[model samples]
Target: MSLAPRAVLVHRTTEYEELLARHGTAGQAAFFLTSRGRDLEPVAARHARARRTLAAVEAAVPLHWRRARVERADLDRFLFGPEDVVVVVGADGLVANTAKYLTGQPVVGVDPEPGRGLGVLVRHRPADTARLLTAAVRPDAAFDELTMVEAVADDTQRIRALNEIYLGAPGHQTARYRLATATRPDPAAPEESQASSGVLVGTGTGATGWLRSLWRERSGPPALPAPTDPRLLWFVREAWPSPTTNTTLVQGALTNGDHLRLVVESDRLVAFGDGVETDALELTWGQTIRVGLADLRLRLLV
Candidate 1:
């Protein structure tokens, strides 16, 4: 488990070949899969090729089959269960499936086409498939009993190693939310105030994203706000703001301390991490939505 991942991009021959070259048939491995929304032909073909290649790899691990692997139980296997990595190739749907199935999780969303997948792509990161699932068995997400301040074991590495975290509309509303934060950080009393139209959580890992969005309203390269580590939170809002189910967590003394509420007296509001909607929770005014920094820190292959 102390090595690179068993790379699983989308369903592709080239992707498999590429990842295979990086980490050969090793300890434990798998092909965690999701529908490409395309004919299974391509995926089947890639599976054949991957299977054949995997057959030849001496260090390869047994490949297990988890039918309809995107649901909660199956996804639990995807996230915390021990095995090695299950590579996800090209398309983002499968990548998204993985994220949707987990919580307080950091998923590196990779978009092959920037124009088509700007929002989701920015969230994906290359991961160590082998390491993530090793004895994961739904490990304790809280880091209260850690031997060190930094995580020596699994500690929200999903988000921390990836460094950046994303917030987006929970549904297809295209709705945006207001942002607010304390001028000074007060964890004990985070919900004391609210301000601004756009809410962004900028971390030390995602500087450019929070800052650049401020410049062009909504324009930037695919790789801005990339975080080296998780620290700091940026709050942003859109100009000529349209309604969105999104809410930004204020960094300072206010919102972080307690229940952050999104008022939905008239219209409904959706909330989610990054852009996936399964966990995209609907909200009502005076209703409490949870938000906070998780203790688990990711250890990247880098």
Candidate 2:
């Protein structure tokens, strides 16, 4: 028989700890919060609850499987194998953060604070860890296969996103990139190009996120990606109409097997997945980035 897959618990630092780390002392942090009309009690309470939830989750793990805990900041250093299941012990954003590094592994999102909105990805409470983990490892497990987006650069540097992939400058300055896209579902369609501020390629799971805000601004937002839709939505931000640049190809959808390509006409451009800027791919002039639906899907346990 095969060994039980390891359950990797992922979490991040709480607001309380971040404040203390910045202020160097609890007393100093409290004083700083008071000056800003914020109290430390609420933050402390939330952090305490998170701790309890983590304890319960770890204790609930079965003995046959190896258990490991990792902080969100340390995810890049941690090694995950095919026989491992990832458990995110935070809000939906944490799930998005954890999904980029994953390759078709089952992910269980635990809402540490049940009172707050759990978001679609995190469907279970901390108390549900044991049962969820057990179901996740089974062959007959029922899961929502969430779509993911990918960006590959000329240098071969690649990244994936469960929510969205942002391509822009570090400081939000004017980003100059010549964009061309081939709508995969319609191969006979000719590719087009444009110069713009930046590009945003998102999945169906990201419809309600940053992409949603952009969608709301337009009289008609292209139908947002559905949770199981094997397609990606692409939008160019503030496409500048210049004598040298065409603004006609500002928005489109990239179906599965199709890709959107961008040539960095500017000196520099950066690509980050799911809002994690630290983990990014940097490109220079003449570099090409291809965006499309990723081969791996996030199997989120409901």
Candidate 3:
């Protein structure tokens, strides 16, 4: 007596033929998420996998892949218009890739990444690794309006950006600190607190990539909002103080109210973005620079 319609996905669904058949009937469109040419070349003689299944899938469903943006050719094909009933074989790239291309259609992340089952890391399963961490992400508004990419946004599906945000220093030199504030020309006077090295601020979508790691030390992991609540700023660095200082100011104060200030005693200070050199911000023993969330946001297709 149920009237809801269903669709089948055939990317890695070689074993779900019956299920596919059930969903493919009654004039409903089936959606399949496949590697296209992204799949590794098959062996010289073995075609026992979904190669034939994919061909049958072509006959089964009218593929509605992403094609929304030139930069997202790989992902754009997967996103369908809002009125479509969609099913997809989601993986790391597929899920993250789907964010920019989804057309507001109701979609099921089918054949998702083995570990998480579904959500975020959809179907990126490894042949060797069994356990993997999964997180949801959106986009940063600061860079969304950009027509061309001058600087690759923080969450550009690039692995390097995530690694820099989560991983700490190699040895134990300590993540040094300088003030990240709004005031120009920096601060003076040592009356406040000692600044720690690089702190990271995140929107909700970025919470899983960097905030979760820092939460292990300070706050616990919260839900993934489009951009998290109260806005997140992370202090990532390996420069733990030598215990010689009198007072250490962690996530200190700022005049902007929402911002934070860091005061380090040493002049060997630098401001790095993610993990690259941003600029050599010269500072005195006591100075204040404001740090707060930027007025930007991102939209993700889920």
Superposed on all Cα atoms, the candidates' RMSDs to the truth, in angstroms, are: 12.3, 1.8, 14.7
Residues 1-302, candidate 3, lDDT per residue (tens digit)? 43222232414323244434555632221233122332112221123333443333334342332212122233323434443333445443343333333333333343322454435533332221111111111122111210000111222321112112221122223434443332323445333323244455443444555555665565343443343243444444333555543223333221222444455445434332233332223434444343444332222223
TM-score, model 3 to reference? 0.37
Candidate 2 per-residue lDDT over residues 1-302, each given as its tens digit: 87678999999999988998999998999999999999989998998989999999999888888989999999889888888899999999999999988888899999887768746887798888999999998889999999999999879999999999999887768887766665653545554455666888888899888888777776666788797899888888887777777777777888867898888878888999988999999999889889998999999987
Query: Which sections of candidate 3 miss by over 4 Å?
Result: 1-118, 121-173, 180-197, 206-210, 219-230, 236-239, 242-247, 252-294
- Candidate 2 overall Cα lDDT vs. reference? 0.86
The lDDT values for all models are 0.34, 0.86, 0.34
lDDT of 3 at 158: 19
> What is candidate 1's lDDT per residue for 78-184, written digit by digit as tens?
44333233333334344433433333323333323335444432332223233333322234422211000111111212221122233334333333333323333
Candidate 1 displacement at residue 128 in angstroms? 12
- Give candidate 1 misplaced runs (Cα > 4 Å): 1-59, 62-79, 82-198, 202-226, 239-267
TM per prediction = 0.42, 0.95, 0.37
Off by over 4 Å in 2: 185-193
Model 1: weakest 10-residue lDDT segment is: 144-153
